[model samples]
Target: MGRWEPDARGRLRAAAIELFSERGFDQTTVADIAERAGVTERTFFRHFADKREVLFEGSQVLQATVIEAIASAEPGTPPIETVAAAMQAGAGLLQGNRDYSRLRATAIAANPSLHERELLKLGRLAAAAAEALRDRGVAEPAASLAAQTGVTLFSVGFEKWLTDGAVDDFALHIRESLAELKALTGDA
Candidate 1:
């Protein structure tokens, strides 16, 4: 090899992005990615359950962060406010990782399979957010609505941050987006 490849997870993710971008997710194969990453097929399998997981890496951590943010929020806070607070906490975890984040998101958005996984991640985030709010005794659709709204706002904010080329602070955009979403939903 000309250049030493990255670790298994890194290699897998990079390979996925490249392959998905080139041939589309539906057309790419594990053998293709393994070949590109200079790793064995077993190595790729070790790091990711499938090609889609490579594109959607770190989602488990993200979900945990969003959920933990809500759990760590102060009592009596409104549901949307808690979600915003959690997003701020989670964004701190992603600080200075903008380039990689943008690259990963763009690759996912470029492929239907990855996009579906992205939607599933967002849905899980919403459910987790709602569970956290439910622990706070917020009732019924309020918690569900707030959690879903928060997830949507977070996605909007993240996309804007990636594409707008104007803002650099993910957390600040999340706050602004949450505020906007709240106002739009009459939650504020």
Candidate 2:
């Protein structure tokens, strides 16, 4: 399956990024993405409802993975610490694919449509996290605030690392960002 189909979703995403970057997101069609992936348009739809989804895919996976990571964190860890640990896990998930991230980030930055979708993806991820926090026994505002703060730290850490050519360790950057956030809000 990893050979023939070879993660159809991933292939579609890579193809969509390349096409969007080369031809502009608005100009690129699902067929273009499918062709670039050497797959059928039907295959593209199977993996994603449309081209916008190609950019948003990781946000969904990230949310789910982070939630699982948080759920499995040591019981003694504080709620915020658990969330931070999950963010570190997410950073790990993205660390091996800097080139792909650069491509997607550039593509999103260049295209207004992609940018909107990216923002929506971030919001959805935060909301999902807040729901997970509630399940983990966190209260109202704290749950939402903690989740959004985690997302913000992740975003700042990612950009800082990316701008510095990923020189800093991504996990460490997130931890520092979280500390800075705590200092700013006096939440720590």
Candidate 3:
């Protein structure tokens, strides 16, 4: 790895995760990540705001993907179903990155601050989804309920996807979780 490498961003992300895993998130610093990635602190800053940002850089993209799916869903689709489909679409971003996802999850789970940050990220995603639903003419409580449920479904499904080594389809896990939710609500 070199400072001139084409995937400096990718290298920085990988290095950050690696360092976070080995040193723990609290122990790892931007300088450590930059050194591990063979880049300057300036290069690392160019890629991310801070070490924590490396773990959350994809959040905006994930939210955007979910919002787009919700906006594009067929007219007359149920709110829950639309949000579920949107979450599934968002899951696509994590496909083929299971190993990294698992490592990232581990790192986040180990640190209280990281866990709080993760929760905040999920909250933002849900809020954005709710707004998208409102844009699609979904009513207030229904939009918020569907968006919150969808975010919960996504969280459950993502955990299952990460822990179940044999399963690779994130959407399937989400569908299964949604089914379970429906069963609980007598909607199954």
Candidate with top TM-score is 3
Candidate 2 lDDT, tens digit per residue, 29-144? 99888888888888777778778877776776788888898778776677788788889988987887877888888988997767887888788878887888888888999889
Point out the worst 10-residue segment of candidate 2 by lDDT.
Answer: 160-169
Best by lDDT: 3
Return whichever of 1 and 2 wins on lDDT: 2
Rate residue 54 of model 1 by lDDT: 73
TM-score of each: 0.84, 0.84, 0.95
lDDT of 3 at 27: 91
Ranking of all candidate structures by their lDDT, best first: 3, 2, 1
lDDT (C-alpha, whole model) for all candidates: 0.80, 0.82, 0.93
TM-score of 3: 0.95
Steric collisions counted per model: 0, 0, 0
Give a tens-digit lDDT track for model 1, residues 1-188.
22444566776777777777778778889999999887888888777888877756677888898888888788888887888788777787777878778777767777676688789888988898898889889898999988988887778878777877878888888888876765786845
The TM-score that candidate 2 achieves is 0.84
